[model samples]
Target: MLYHCFLLIASLRSVVAMETCPTTGMPGIPGIPGMPGRDGREGEKGEKGQPGAVLHGGLDLQKGEKGAPGMMGYAGKRGQNGEPGKSGSSGIAGPPGQPGDPGAVGVQLKAAFSVARGTHEFPQKASIIRFTKVITNINDDYDTESGRFRCRVPGAYYFVFHASLGNKLCVLMKLDQTLIASFCDHRYRRQQVTSGGLAVYLSRNQEVWMETKDYRGMRGQQNGHSIFSGFLLHPH
Candidate 1:
């Protein structure tokens, strides 16, 4: 009886070993996916995704725009200064500036005058011809009382004069008693007009004026036809 019981127990053990248990975990091997559920009636859209980094791929792959630039990196320490280079040889000196046009000497002397007391003829005596129109008188160098320009600056000057004569007229221009220019008309038959100019070096206080040869010969016309002008050309 004991031997029979032992044999029965052995047989039962063998049968239990041969029998397998149902699998209780994920499938050991991939199984055919079940037909997707009817997508469960479209769910609410998910939150937007964060921006991505700049992509480095074919142009076709870069559908999305480039991402914002990365934050600037921390500044680096300054580098040591480099050694100075050797000085180059001195450059050739420039040609002496063309003497600079005498710098326009600062003397401001200019004047223009016309006969004063119209219709009043001058005397035969070598007298100063006064002027009425004080067109321009700088430094008061020209006198309207006594038609004359007294040189205040020692420099070369230019002078001009105009005279209208009806009868025989003779006008002489004198620079401090020195004859400069003369305008004469011996033809007492017709009217005559004369214009003249001169440039001369004048010393300080030298006077310039005109004198009539004959008072009756040089009669003043109602229309002012006499003028005198002068200006410093250049200072010595």
Candidate 2:
């Protein structure tokens, strides 16, 4: 019919282009790089958003209500008494005070004796003697009013003599005039006559005297019994 309908429309367009494109010929020049694609599965969590309400849209800022604590503040006026403290640096002179103890040696005394006033039952000059003083003024002790025997403290001095004479008389003790002690022809108070201690070194003016010999107790009744005492010693 028109060529079998144009040969059945060209054989149904060649079987509908060979069932549409079996290897559509003319498209094959890009094939050398194809093995890489496998990692994409994670995306699901998004729902939370609601908090925004503070909008005081104002224009008069007047906070005025705290004004009652202002009535107790009046006591701060005493600050002018601090200017007298500058005298503290004089303490370094205390190491020179230690020496006081040595004062004890002061003793003095004086005395002398010789009393026999009269009755010369036998007298040969020595009225009644006993005297020995002068050891640097021996600490004296016996001065029946200037009978002599004095030395307040100087050293060595001693004298002792006692005598009676109605039948005896010869005792003496003297210094300066020499002769120290002596007794002879004794016999009184039954018999007692002594005159034998005499050592001198008297000072402090010095003095000592005593005498008695005998005319047999000078005139009578025991002429003048001798007697004398004086002493002082401290130097061996």
Candidate 3:
């Protein structure tokens, strides 16, 4: 006994130091959850994090559903012709046109004539002074057996004559073979009375006569002392 083996090694080191010492007591009743362990191999992507701090005053957002019509865009190059517009001020004048219908009733042209000389003969050089007294040949345009007047209406006439010379005469008045008027009485055994006139413009069977350059006098008077007249002063 070496002192009874040192008191049995000091009572087995005080029972192994009270079974390795760590016991503050009461926290041991939660342990029956254990079947979730196999998922741990995905961890390397973390270094880009520093930009998120500008959000001041939020809360007002309910109006957003109109967006589905966008696919027709390739036609834009026709824009260079627009500079000519400044002339507008003049419009007001229309009212007055209605009155037309009533016309047709004219033509009444009536030429005239009057003749005398019923022969006391003394007119025969370039002779054409016949007249057997008609005294008013309305449109029988005078031709008392060809002492001519013939111009059955074409314009401006008015001829006239009156001669009753008794000796030397020389009258003329023609118009076709034109020499409109003349008269010379030469008094040789005078019994004078002479006259002549004209205002011609005939054309339409044109004639008109009274020619005796000098085949001496004439005194044909049955109250009409040698005459010749014409009229129609209008129609052309």
Candidate 4:
């Protein structure tokens, strides 16, 4: 029995070595890389996630190129009128202007005349000697026939006169019965000449003229040497 048992055990050991067992086999040469397996079935569709947040406080983005303008839209309805605005406050007053310069000198009222008529007589009472010739009479204040100048204004006036006589003669300048000036012949001569002048302020409508109370008559040879003249220097 003992001999049989030993034989059997040795046979069992030989069988194990020759036969392969799944779990205890030697690793084979790396497999011929496997024939690839089929792709897995597609996965189920996933749920949509929440919206992302807006980024801030980062480097500035470059400006994009401008886009083409859009087509114009239709005109809109008219709007209601707006209310009127309130009036503004008044501004402060400005400074006063400077005074203007004195006005220019007034129009000159003046006259100049020469004796043109022949020598004529005069009464003992003062008589006017007519100066028939006129050199200039502004405003026509002097009358050659009347031998009078009617003052048109109340103002200072200047008068000048010259008389020429064939014989002894005397001539006087009267302003409204007031003898303003006079000239008289000095002595018997072929032509005696005398001249007189005056400056006086006369009221409106006062008269001035040449006159002689005691002389036979004034004499003039119809020459410009015998002259009568007056002018307004300034008005009151």
Q: Among these predicted structures, which one has the highest lDDT?
A: 3
lDDT of 4 by residue, 141-231 (tens): 8888788988886788888876666556677888888887777765766656766788888888889887865663445555424667888
> Which ten-residue region of model 4 has the weakest summed lDDT?
115-124
Q: How displaced is residue 43 in candidate 3, in Å?
A: 99
Which residue pairs show backbone clashes in model 4? none
lDDT of each: 0.70, 0.54, 0.79, 0.71
Candidate 2: tens digits of C-alpha lDDT, residues 57-127: 55556555787777888899999999899899988898888775554343333334334433443444645
Residue 171 Cα positional deviation in candidate 3, in Å, after optimal superposition: 14
| Superior candidate under TM-score, 2 versus 3 | 3
Positional deviation of 147 in candidate 1, in angstroms?
Answer: 2.3
Off by over 4 Å in 2: 1-104, 108-150, 153-161, 164-166, 170-189, 192-203, 213-227, 231-236
Model with the higher lDDT, candidate 1 or 2: 1
Per-candidate count of clashing residue pairs (backbone under 3 Å): 0, 33, 0, 0
Please identify model 4 stretches exceeding 4 Å from their true place: 1-105, 108-126
TM-score of each: 0.47, 0.21, 0.23, 0.48
Model 2 gets an lDDT of 0.54
Model 4, 142: alpha-carbon shift in Å? 0.7
Put down candidate 3 lDDT per residue, 1-236, tens digits, no spaces: 79999999998887887788735768889989999899999999999999985544565555567999999999999999999999999989889888655442232477788888887766677778887778788757787888898887689998988877777777788889888778777765656677778788898898988888855576786642888888888889
Q: Could you give candidate 1's per-residue lDDT for residues 1-236 as a string of tens digits?
A: 99999999998876776685433566588778898676557779999999987667844565667899999999999999999999999998988766644535443444333333354565445566665565567777887767678888788988877766555667778998889988776766655666678898898889998776554254455663566678888776
